[model samples]
Target: MASGAEARDRLAQTAMYDRVESALNLVNERKSGLTVPNKWAFEARVGGSVSGAQLAITWSRRNEPEATLYLNNDVEPELAAKTLLDRTYGLIAASFADRIIGRDGARDVSASMLRRVANRLNELYTGRFDEIIHGQSLPLVSIDHLERAGPNPFLYHARTGEVLGDFTGLVRQALDRLIQRNRLRIEDVDVGLLASLFRELFSNTHLHARTDLEGALYRRSARGIVFALRPVDIPHDSFAAGLPVLKEYIESMEREAARPRVEFLEVSVFDSGPGLAARTLRSVVPADLPIEREYELVQKCFLKTYTSVSNPAHGWGLPRVMHALKSSGGFMRLRTGRLSLCKWFPPGMKDPRVTADDLQFMDIGGGSPKRHARVEGAVFTILIPVGLGN
Candidate 1:
């Protein structure tokens, strides 16, 4: 492809994702019936085995040589899912492999088996997630979800993009499965509360995070949120070390139970955008301010009064999230800029004044005076104690 001085064409020219043109748009545009512009086209073919049942993807670029990148066959579902998942996230970073065109079983499986498949991919790409404070994707999509596929009480409520629906839809699907799986173990959950928690997080991303659309920078890109929810053993060495509250909670849980069985939900919500403060303060912050003061000001985002979005209805998102988690005794680690803020909302302590006070601050990657190695965008981890008091 050639770059022509950033011409803003009416149609954003990209490629076919599900592998070719004329395939079901992965990113459905809903009721208006307008054709969603796919940066890449994705199409899957049905064979003797079945169309929706077996999908293989061959990502192609216009004017460039074409190759069958991957195809999904029922015989090897995990491999098929792995192939597509690898391609999607990989291409996301692997130089413009966009567009998905399949409406077959591959779509169902990939979306359905998000946790099982994503966890597997995370292991393949990022090694075992159990050892880290941040698990890449959660609600753990895996091949198991596909193998034992059923109506697990999880449903796609809404979507944000043609590829993955909206951020809320993505979060709902993951949590639904997590809730479903936990039930088998006879553990009850507050489904409504969980849904609210995810919605608020999605609102943050929708409002604050700038999205990446095949290397194109836009005020808001419809790249649906990437998230996950997986069960984790409490008191992991790395986690306890970083989060002060984790150690205390573990000790309390153990003291109560003679034989403790502590399970924690590792929730991952990541957005590829500038730091919260930078994106929010793009216009608010003056160009020539000293870096430290600038950093301090950005930290004020959790407060309702310090909102960046002009909409009146939007300011309450983060504050509401904190209240929800606090009511449920949940904890979260928020990473942005050079600050890694961890704060657990205890069961009974209610802080009235908006959020910041609820978090403990740290510099994870490296810097001084509010600085270090910074994340390219924003990463948030919500830790919910499953079956603890519910």
Candidate 2:
């Protein structure tokens, strides 16, 4: 009910997590110029988001040990023709002429600060992962950390994956590495389908975002995205807690591996576009719609008719992803805006892609979608058996 800016004084009096909660609500509001003040320093604390691009933008503005971005709109758009970044730049140019004037103003702020302030707001958004994460000092994957890691632990840059020229390059590298390291053969039916599945997800995250402020997707984006797949071993009791289908899938996988512990790769991809709520709000809600509608529309993304585009190929991306996971007995959790969905496939549920009749089979969790700490963009976490290649 209270706005992000309004929560400021209230936040000052509360404890740490309470302040974190307030910050999350501000970012979710989808308005630019949101500020969360405190005795904060630069750090990587997860959970944050924007209006339309749920995965990316949400992570960018995620309330961390540092401050949330305001006056920057590359990730979350608040208007037409210009992002909050462009508009904020214009306002700053007029109000604080000495500090910055239009594009040239970026030079005044540290690249790190500018990134949080205006992620991918400029032409040169791609660079080294070390600087993107820990600045120029520490190696992206610390050699010391590697020594302590288990045999299956993947060494990667958490703040940003391998720095690429663009999000497209990131997608290629992530998928390629997964296949190569796993020794997946092209002839395997699941291999090609797996590639297709991630390809569609990676490409769609880049494509689907349409900010009321900007017309083009790639043209306005400068910073790169990150995707990582790491190994995880689920405990038997926890497996039981998952959807009944997931428990069986894990059981079968362990039986095949013939090991006491089963390893699964946790795949994650993040993008900084306005969240689904903000994008749909542009078309669906003329007046104040229920905040819960954000969650409902996201679930509807699995249906055939719910698409943001007129193209014949637009709506099938997620369904295909689910189908591939089902083929491989995978499980997933998706978080964006006010929605979070978790689905487990036993390979027996009615096909979602072919028929809308089985929509109820989907498993989605519920909570306060507007809690200040949640992300503004989209973040996907999927668990698939590591031995998928064999």
Candidate 3:
């Protein structure tokens, strides 16, 4: 017979796993609608809601729950906004067809923010706005599409040179803003390399994200490159406990800095399609494959010469991005399918080139890989730290 303490510990663990599994099923299993719990438990569940809400909007069926979001009164507008704003959650929720209902006259701040951003995204997608809206004032050159482009259409209508130049310019501007805000100094060469990194990421989405697993164009999908800036303070203890791999890198940055926190310009490119492993393997990943095998398949994507496409000349993108991050001492987190992996590069590392082995399963504040929920699409978040300015 288990003691009371043991019973409580088991219950806690079960709750954690249940939360993770619920989020996964909400996205992957195609539930009728989303019911967002109160704000306290929302953070753990919102990631799944993002994808699930998008699915609800795009995959609506007759006689189904009206693709609605049922909200509770304990939720705050700002918390809901912030959670939805992370990655593509806000956009997906805004695109939802049915109403977002709040119980007991609770304010639906999420609905308002979603609508605002959805309008902006539509404007940007239709070329009415030259830049995308991150918030009310931050205009970024981004691409967001709620509907499918025609079959085999050009991903970007602009000329390759022009699009690349626009993307590079936006990246440079974003980095400049980060530098000014954080009083950081970055070299011109580094700025250009970072710009290239984003360009390649956007290019990658174009190459791999337009179709379903069977190569048919998706009738409805959410795909885009979005940017946001966040200030993060990873206390020494937390770093040591949860993310020891980044310890050296964080320490090196904080050595002479006045504050321990680092400001990161987050660049996230997400797409609703078959995820990285599925696309790389050109088939659905076997459901029974060990987690280790799944991790290996994701790592294979960063190999120096990996091309899921047919062209022999087009396999260097991911490796180049890896090398650039290693050189710039940046951090990246990739969530796709059942894997959440990350790699950190400290400045002046002995081997500037990243290999597949360097990728590790991300520790989600639990010191283990068990917390990861399967994401329907691929989401890659690249965090480039802004250093203290001279």
Best by TM-score: 3
Please, what are the lDDT tens digits per residue for candidate 1 over residues 88-109?
2322321221222232412322
- Deviation (Å) of 172 in candidate 2: 8.9
Number of clashing residue pairs in every model?
52, 32, 2
Clashing pairs in 3: 84-90, 183-389
* Model 2 lDDT tens row, 73-129: 223222411332222212111121112212222233434333433332221133333
Please give the CA lDDT of all the candidate structures: 0.39, 0.39, 0.52
Taking all chains together, each candidate's TM-score versus the true structure is 0.52, 0.51, 0.68
Query: lDDT winner among the candidates?
Result: 3
Arranged by TM-score with the best first, the candidates are 3, 1, 2
**Native-structure RMSD, model 3:** 7.7
How many collisions between residues are there in candidate 3? 2
